[model samples]
Target: MKNLSLQWRITLMTALLIGATCIFMNVLIGYSGRHYMDSIGSHITGYEETGGEDPDFFDPRRERLDQELTIVIHGAQESFIATNWYITAAAALLGGVLAYFLSGHALKPLRTFAAQVEKVQPNNLTDTKIPEAVLPEFRQFSRSFNQMLDRLDSGFAAQRQFTGNAAHELRTPLSLMQAQLELFSAEHPEVSPETADFLRLLREQTERMTQMTKTLLEMSELRTVPCTERIEIGPMVEEIFTDLAPLAERKNITLKATGDGTMTGSDTLLYRLLYNLTENAIRYNRPDGTVHIAVAYEASCLHITVTDTGCGIPQPYRESIFQPFFRVDKSRSRENGGVGLGLSLAWEIVALHGGEIRVAESSEKGTTIAVSFPTDASAD
Candidate 1:
């Protein structure tokens, strides 16, 4: 009973109720019939001696009348018990069917609310909310859920604005510091080896900070960016591969692009999306490793896969790889000049285009990332 679904529970309870009512009615009828029969017998016995008949006389006709009356009442009792059993069974069956459907009908609003909730995403947070329901309880639930969504929308907006502002503010100071450090290093050509090493380290840190700030700004603005241009997948892949070929060549890694697909999106953002993925593939790969890019259309959706023969991501880290500032191998990431934001930025770009990005496969051998986007020209 505890494990039963709502509909089943409702049906069972309804059937039990109907059966109980029928049993109670049957018991009342039987009791009343027996009492009436006893009263009539008493009256019949009293009347038998009313017409100057012997009080103790065994009258054959009177005996026959009494016997017939007893038979008739006993037969009626038996008929009623049998008939009531059939009626109770039929009522229980009917009640179960009605309860099953009635429960489903009553829960339809909750099902609709769940479906709407599933479609809500950060990019479209403001536009999605639970619609009003007719039932009072469901209506209240919808109202509360909409209020929660409003708070979430406000919080996300504030976070994005703050990130953008902070990133913008940090960039100017970083640029000025980099220029000042370069001027000081050039002016002090006779500095000790230790001072030169310190200055070089300072310059490197400043550059890293500048890159991080730029990535942060890009991530912050992704929510407000709109994708309106139609891009051919084949050409875009070719161009991205060409642009990143130098980086791949430095490690003797091979870059290959194949298949044809197209989607509607911002070209700049899409470029960044592919660039980050390809760049990571190149940066993390072993010498002479291969990076493969493929795009294809399936069921009105475009599928893009990037596979790299690099040191694969661990299973535990794969889930958090797209999170900002999360790195699987911190030391390796630093050596590769990674600030742990490439995949995070890629994820944001994919979300902005209303697509999905996921690590399709990973192991000690290598890793593969698959992205899917609606092929519809109007998808955003």
Candidate 2:
């Protein structure tokens, strides 16, 4: 909706064109005037210098007449030049003003088209009908933009459908597993302690699998959820710290959070983003190391940084770390009980909120991952 964006570059070009034309026109007019004056002055001076009407007679009185005639010709030439100069100056001024206004009027349709495009929301993105623009040449461009919107809307719909179906399918098996484990445990109290312990571990693993499946399904659903809610980011960060403190303590790691501010986004998504970030920091930290969480409101974004004194990610693999199923050290990932989707989910959540998440810095010293969200977006 800005009045003077790069889309109006054509306006500047039009002004330049008008300026060049004015300069060229003035130059041509001046050249013609000079030619006319030279020809007329030479003929009159020649006639006066010759006493006879013939081409070759010379006299003292005739020479004096030639001087007078030259003066008069020069005065007339000056008057003609001055008049033309005024006319040309007025024409140049008028042209410049006319060009400026004309350029703005010509670009008005483009501005309206862009404003319409900006008004599109995710829910209505599937609609392919773009508002008609005044300029015929822009119709094709409008069609292409609407087509892209349709494809994106279809993509998000598909993702949502897949997640819904997958969650339904997984719930049945998860329920059966829980029932079987409960029956087995209830019927086997008379068994040896080791056998009981084994059954307990089996039950635990099954529950873990259920939790993982549910988290994965939620992560998939988060992709399609419109992030239009307002969030008190400071409180959200506090809640994450409270939730993960016990887990960090179990690993002999100290987890801490600092800074307080509000940001815009879905509360569920913001929690997920912070959870993944903090969990990674704690999981990767060395024994008894410190994991730091900081939140600060910057110029236009709310920044959350998670730093850990862990086995830092190598420089070569930083770019790939946010990709699903990507692990710098596969064995290390297994040791940390990671499926390599945590950061990927975090990345998607950040992107859904029109923000960004990345490993801002990494080395043997430590690694710092920053997740940022726009401060203007409301958190749901």
The candidate that wins on TM-score is 1
TM-score of each: 0.83, 0.70
The CA-based lDDT of model 1 is what?
0.86
Q: Can you write out model 1's per-residue Cα lDDT over 206-321, one digit (the tens) per residue?
A: 99999999999998888667788888878988898899888988999999888887678898898999999999999988899999999887777889999999989888888899
lDDT of 2 by residue, 161-259 (tens): 887688779978987999998998888769899988888887777776676677668776775676667677677877887898898888899877788
Give the best candidate by lDDT: 1
- List where candidate 2 sits over 4 angstroms from the true fold: 1-31, 46-134, 178-209, 223-231, 315-319, 378-380
**In model 1, what is the error at residue 80, expressed in angstroms?**
5.9
Every candidate's lDDT: 0.86, 0.76
Give the least accurate 10-residue stretch of model 2, judged by summed lDDT.
6-15
After superposition on all CA atoms, how large is the RMSD of candidate 1? 4.0
